[model samples]
Target: MCNTVKVSPRKLDPETRAALVDIAAKLLAEHGAEALSTRKIAAEAGTSTMAVYTHFGSMSGLVREMVHEGFARLERQFAKVRRTDDPVADMAVLGYAYRQNAKANSHLYAVMFGGQSLAGFSLTEEDRQYGRYTLLTVIDCATRCIEAGRFRQGDPRPIAHEMWIATHGVVNLELGGYLIDPANADRCYDGMLSSLLVGAGDEQRAVTASMAASKRRRRREVEVDPEPAEAVATRR
Candidate 1:
C-alpha cells in the first residue's frame, strides 16, 4: 500500500494576523475594493495564498476582519481620552480623538465606514451595528453634557449622532483631498466643532473655553508621545 501523508494548514500568530489585516487595508485603499486580490495581498505580505485561507477562511473573511480592526483602533483611541469634570471639554476631546483615529488609519477608515465595499464582501447589518458601538463613548459624553446643563435636554443618542455626522463630514472631506492645507483644515474643523456645540445650546464663551481646554489636552498628549513621521507627513 502507498504511504499516505497529511499536511495541516499553518497557523498564524496574532502579530501575523494583524499584519495581514493591515496589508489588506493598504491594498484596499490604494487599489479600490474591486481590485483587491488574494494573490496580490499574499504576495505583498510575503505569504502564500493558502495563508490567507488558513488565517481568515477567505478573502471576504479577511475584509470583515479589516472592518473590525479599524473600529478596534478607534475604540482604543477613544479609550485614551480620559474624562474630566468638564463634560463639554471631554466631548471636545472625543471629537479630536475621532479625527486623530481617522488620520492615523486613513487606509482603513473608508472601509470601516462603508465608503467602498470589497468585491467579495458586504457588511451585514450586524457588522454596521458593531461599528456603531464605538460611538457609545460619545453618547455617554453627550449624556453627561445634558445632565450638566451644558447641552439642551434631549436624547443622548441624537446628540451623539449629530456630533458624529459633523466630525465625519470634516474627516471625509479631508481624506478626499478637499481640505488640503493642514492649517486650513485645522481651523475649519475647530470652527465647525464650536458652531455645532453652540447650536446644541452651549454658550459661546463656554464652547470657547471647552475648545481651549481640548487643545491644551491634545498638546500635552503630543508632548508626551509625538505622532509618527509617516502620520505627520500624511497631514502635510
Candidate 2:
C-alpha cells in the first residue's frame, strides 16, 4: 500500500475565511453546487484541501456558511437603503436595493432559493430560517406604514410577505432574463413596487406622483427614516 500524503492546515484568519467564502461562491456560481467540492474551493483560494476542514469543518458546513453569507450580503445591501420619511417611498427604495443585490449576485441568489442543486446536503430548520431577518426589513416598513395609518390594521407580516413575494417573483423573472425588454426592466420593477405599495393601503395618487417625482429628482438613493438595523441579522 502507498503512503498517504498529508497537507498541513492553513492558518485561519478573518481575511482568509472571507476569501474562502468568496471563492466558494464563485465556484458555486460557475460549476453548480455539486461541483463545490472542498478541494476545488481550497485550490481556487490557493490553500490546501485540509483548510476547508480546518476553517469550516466539512463541505456541508461550508455550504451552510454559503447560504448564511448570501442572506448576510442581502441584509447589508438593504441596510444601506435610505429610509425616507415616507415609509411607502422608503419601501420602494428597499425593493430597488433588493433587485440590485440579486442582479449583482445572480448565481448565489439562484443557489439560495434553488436548493435542489445541493440535494445531498441536509439543512436544519434553523438553516432554512437563516434569512428571515432580511425579510423583516419589509415587515418593519409595513409596520411603520400601518402605524402611520397607511395600511389596514392587522399583523403586518403577511402583508409584507406578499410584497416580498411579489418583489421576489419579479426579480427572479428579471434575473432569469424572462422580461421581454430587459432595458425597460427598471420601469417595470418600479411600477410593480408602486402597485404593491398601493396594495398595502398607501394613497394611490400620492404614491404614483411621489414615484414620478422620485424618478425625476433622483433623490431616492438618499437613505432616511429607516428603522434601526443593529439587531436585524440576529433575529430569526
Candidate 3:
C-alpha cells in the first residue's frame, strides 16, 4: 500500500485541483489509509483518472499534497489561539485542537505522521516548510508557557515534543478503538493535558466532572425498567 502509484495532477485548473484535493481528504477521513487511491479518488470526484495524474503527478504526489494540506490546517487551528495571553491556557487549548484535528482526519493523520512512506519518495521542501510551520507553532506556545513560568524552565522544543506525544497517545488510543467511553473523553483529555502543564488545576475539575457523569450514566442504566419475559423471548 505504500508503493508509488504513478499518476498526475499538474494541468487541472486551480479550482478543480483544489476540489480534488478536498475530495481526497474527505475520502481519507471516512475510510482509513487504504482508501487513498487515484482510481478511487477520481471516481468519487467525477473526474477521469487522467485528471488526477495531470494535477498531482502520482499517488506519491497526491499523498504529499495531503500532507502539506494537513499541516496547513494544523497551522490555522493554532493561529486562532496565538493571541491568548495566558500561556498555560493557550497550551491546553492547543492540545484540545490537536486532538480534535487528529480524530477528525484520522486517515491523513495516519498517512502523514503514521511513519509509513512510499518507496523512492521523500518529503519535499514544501512539505518540510509546512511541517516546520506546525512545529514552530507548537514551540511558540510552549516557549510562551516557559517564559511566563507556567512551565518548567528548559528547552521548549523537547517540552513541546513531550506534550505532543502525550496528547497523541490519547487520540491514537481512541482511533485504535481502546477509548470507548465518549463521556470519558474530557477526563482523558484533561488527564493527559495536566501532565504537560506545570501547575494547572482545571485538570482535576474535568476529571471529577467526567467521572461523576459516567457514574450517573451507569447507575441510570442499572435503574432503568426491564422488559418482561415475553418481550425478552420475542427479542431473542
Candidate 4:
C-alpha cells in the first residue's frame, strides 16, 4: 500500500528580522496603526515580542517605517508616470493613475493620512514632498497648456488644487462604495473638468488652440510611423 505524504503549512521562513516588519505591516493594514502593538506583531509572526523590539527598536519605530513605506510607494508610482510633451494629457493620465492607486491601496491611504496619528509617527519632509510631486505634475501640465496658448494665462497653482479636490471627491466616494454606477463617474469627472476650464471668450479660444496643438502633435507622430505595406494593401 502506498502511503500519502502530508504536507506541512509552509512555515514562514523564520527570518525574525524581516518577519517582524512584515507582520507589523499586515497588522497595521488590517487594524489602524493605533491598534498595532509590538507584542501583537511578534505573536502574529510566531516570534517573541522582544524580536520586534530588537529589530525595530519599539512600536513607534515600526509605525515610522510603515508611514515611510506608504509614502515611498506613492512616490515610486508617480515617478513612473511616463512623461509626454502634451502636459494636459499627461495630467489626466496622472490623475487617473492616482485614483487607481488609491482604490487599490485603500488601507495604505487610511494609515498614511486619516488623522489617526500613532505616537512618535510624523511625516518627514521627504514624505511631504511625495505629495508635492503629485501636485507639481498637474501644475506643470496646466502651465504648459497656458504657455502654448491652449489654456488662459492664469496662475496654475490654484487650478491644480481645484483639480485635486475634484479627483479626491470621486476617489473618496468610490472607495466608500457610495458610487455604485460606474458610468456616473466618467460623466461627473468630464463635467467637473469642463466647468473648471470654462471662462471668457479669449480664454476659451486659448483652450481650443492648445487642444488643437496637442492633436496636431499626436497626428504628426503617427504619420512618422507609417503602417506596414501589406496591412495597407489588404485594406484595399
Give the Cα lDDT of each candidate: 0.80, 0.71, 0.64, 0.59
Q: Write the per-residue lDDT of candidate 3 for residues 211-234, one digit (tens) a residue.
A: 344334333222212122223222
> Which one is best on TM-score?
1
Model 4 steric clash pairs: 150-206, 150-210
Worst 10 residues of 4 by lDDT: 221-230
| Residue 126 miss distance in model 1 (angstroms) | 1.2
lDDT of 4 by residue, 1-236 (tens): 99975433243344554455545655666776655887677566665666666656777776666555555655555565556665665555555666656655565565555355675677678656656766787787678767765567789888788878888888888777788787687556555555565531125554444345544443333222212223332332
Best by lDDT: 1
Off by over 4 Å in 1: 1-11, 180-182, 221-236
* Model 2 poorest ten-residue lDDT run: 227-236
Tens-place lDDT per residue, model 2, 106-205, is: 6557667635446355667787686787889988988988888877788999987888788898898898779999999988888887887787777889
Model 2 steric clash pairs: 82-223, 82-224, 83-224
Model 2 root-mean-square deviation:
6.8
Model 2, which residues run further than 4 Å from truth? 1-10, 213-236
lDDT of 4: 0.59
